[model samples]
Target: MKPPTDTDTLTAPADATTVENPAVGIDQTAGNFSYKVDYAFDAGTGLSEDTVRYISSVKKEAPWILEFRLAALKKFFSMPLPTHWATKDLEAIDFQKIRYYLSQGQKPKRTWDEVPDDIKKTFERLGIPEQERKFLAGVEAQFDSEAAYSNIKDIVAKQGVIFVNSTEGLREHPEIFKKFFGKVIPTGDNKFSALNSAVFSGGSFIYVPKGVKVAQPLQAYFRINAENFGQFERTLIICDEGAEVTYMEGCTAPKFSTSTLHSAVVELVALKGAKIQYITVQNWANNVFNLVTKRGIAHEDAEIKWIDCNIGSRLTMKYPGVVLKGERARGEVISIALANDGQHQDTGAKMIHAANHTTSNIVAKSISVGQGRSTYRGVVHIPKHLKGCKNNTECDALLINTNSRTDTYPAITVRGDKNSTQHEASVSKVSEDMIFYMQQRGLTEGQAMSLAVNGFINDLARQFPMEYSVELKRLIDLEMEGSVG
Candidate 1:
């Protein structure tokens, strides 16, 4: 692919302004305060050993970490860009111009009072603090390139649950961090994973010890306020024997004229009898390219579940997967993707049953409107030796306009006769009759469209945390406004 053009090199100013709490008019509310990045750090284009070292140096990382980055950088250089089911527009990525490592302040703040007011208001508007207090066992909020706030409720912390920003975890809990950091997702696994290994920053690290169960979900909110900066968050979660935990991540980027890049790596390890659920709701701006890598490993009798929703982005290519490594393990993935004008949402899941009696289920849905395109590409493999394994996959696509497009590519390989596997796919469009019927009930075109779309995604939405589910509905409703006649 050719390098990004000169026009793509221009970085727009950060759009971190605090909008008037929409409920209150600007006249009645305090003036908007936003953080704008004045100085730009140019992390030259392309993957190189020198670039990796620079990123590590910026973080003041130890020697071993630097070595790991360099190795991953080499892998990134050697790996070929995926030829199938990849965004052709990725040629627009100006690697040289992306600032791989960025920190607005010196260190992550533990107290809200110590955080920059603009950043605080930004999260406050998103109800981060409120959600943390109400439903989360812990919360980590990352603004731009680094986590600005990290907090875990006292009771949960006292339960031997370890929830902290990845950086802090690395510095303070080196033993645990070293054991699992890249074990689930090795640096050389893929191009984006390698890229994340080279320049990752500001993600959550969670460890649920043996026999513990976290009643409340752990939440992490990632916001990109800077223009042309890449956010490479590396998240790791480990649930020891008989433990259970649920993790939710929400991400949004401010509007930008030029595209920003977000390449993240997430790894999960569910040991014997452990259960984990990972949820992600991403609402990136139209001028962003989101390429991410996420996977989990489940041991004997363990379970892993993924709930993903993608609403906005110029181009998004992500597949959250799970590998059942021990007997009787289970995996599940439920996803919904919506693409609107000039957007492409390419996402799905992967399941590899490597042991006896393993089971997996995947349900994927996509909606395309205007000139948007949505595709579901997935894989399910149960090797010949894996006896009594079972898998089920269902993909559904809805196109809202004639110009919109949706496609599904599911690859399933079941080699043993002892295994039972099933796959189903369907494509549909928003019916004019349905719209007219809703209109006859006094609903506007936009409202009808939004309602129909919500109905299609209602099942997946219910899987989200209550607050997230409500917020997601509001966001969808907002995005649907004025979208239809």
Candidate 2:
């Protein structure tokens, strides 16, 4: 395990963490974990008003929702691919070739033991049930297009916390769900947002009551187990005045030659003096495309924070944002992205300082391996009318080899003299010298590489929960295992 010398360059190598060449029955990760579900409800293939109607009718949604879906369908058709500023590869998406929805047409079981055997086995393999029992106050498990299991701890539920799937929430708690359903992220926010609105299904809707603090995090897991399928889940979370809550989501999909699409829209609202933290860790097979839109609004003295990690997708474009709508509101985004061979990770954050004394921060780090590419596209805005507004942005990229690429595009507009902002960006390759030095100290090249990569993002990783931070490091190590070639 000799380390490369100055004259010997280490180009990017294919990632070994994901499964090599996919066969018809193999998943890219989780030890070939996948389910052969027999969905009873299918919206057929493609995107059309009919397809939208089918999905709405199957859900037996209210007339208003059907109207919303129809309107969003029109918008999805009217909007062109956002290739002008985004990657042109978006054109590869063929709405006609993708299935809009697929479901077992069953209600989510409240208990894990009550879930279907096949679905339960899938979650058991993913360790979702165990995680929920150990550390989570609530958990929602969605398989493909519908929730297979959803439950909240009794103690937490008794505190007036409402945690349920979006459909259930809308049907059972309209007064609260309707008030903030599409407020933070409107249907027209983007093409994908429109698409999600047109046929969204199986996502979490959470409401934290005033002055109540959730001691444990609420969790959601989204699994894609079918081929040539599209999953669009819409999640909405609201925290009343002086309330605090944390929600974490994990996503994964099997390896499919035909490709899978995951387009989701998440919206959050934090009332006065409330705090909300949203966390996501997505690891899709290289055959899947992950496109998402997430945004939040922070009211007076409220705080919003987004902790995002992206890995293992053919392409990913996500930008979590926050609007500081009231004075003394604060926003923050901490992001980590790793792109391996044949993968592209495009991620960043957005902050809108709408009131005086609003503050925001963004920290993003990306790793590119093999022929993988990574990009950081961000936006920070402070209006001229706002006073005492401040923003800070930092983006750092790590290139594993000569063939990997990284880019940073930051848009910052601070109009008032009273506002202050700082922006910093950097790109660097893994240092062979450091590897050699560590090798001299008896560390193998792979270990050395993993150590360096971990150190690069250690501070951000530490911000995650203890369990998640460990998992994140383990994934980083898996990515490095194949880089030494």
Model 2 per-residue lDDT tens digits across residues 368-483 = 98899999999999989889999999999998878999999999999979999999898878877988999999999889888888999999998999878877787777777866
Backbone N/Cα/C clashes per model: 3, 0
The lDDT of each candidate is 0.82, 0.87
- The sequence of per-residue lDDT tens digits that candidate 1 reaches over residues 1-485 is 12212221213333644354433211101212335653233344555666666656656677888888888887887887775548668878878777666565336677677766656767776667777666677889987777888888888899999988887788778888888899888998888899899888889999999999998888898887766779999999999999999999988877777788999999999999999999888888777899998999999999999999888889999889999999999999999898888899999999999999999999999999889999999999999976999999999998887899998889999997999999999988898899899999999988998898889888878877777787677667756773665
Residue 35, model 1: Cα distance from true site in angstroms: 2.6
Worst 10 residues of 2 by lDDT: 1-10
The local lDDT score (0 to 100) that residue 231 gets in candidate 1 is: 92
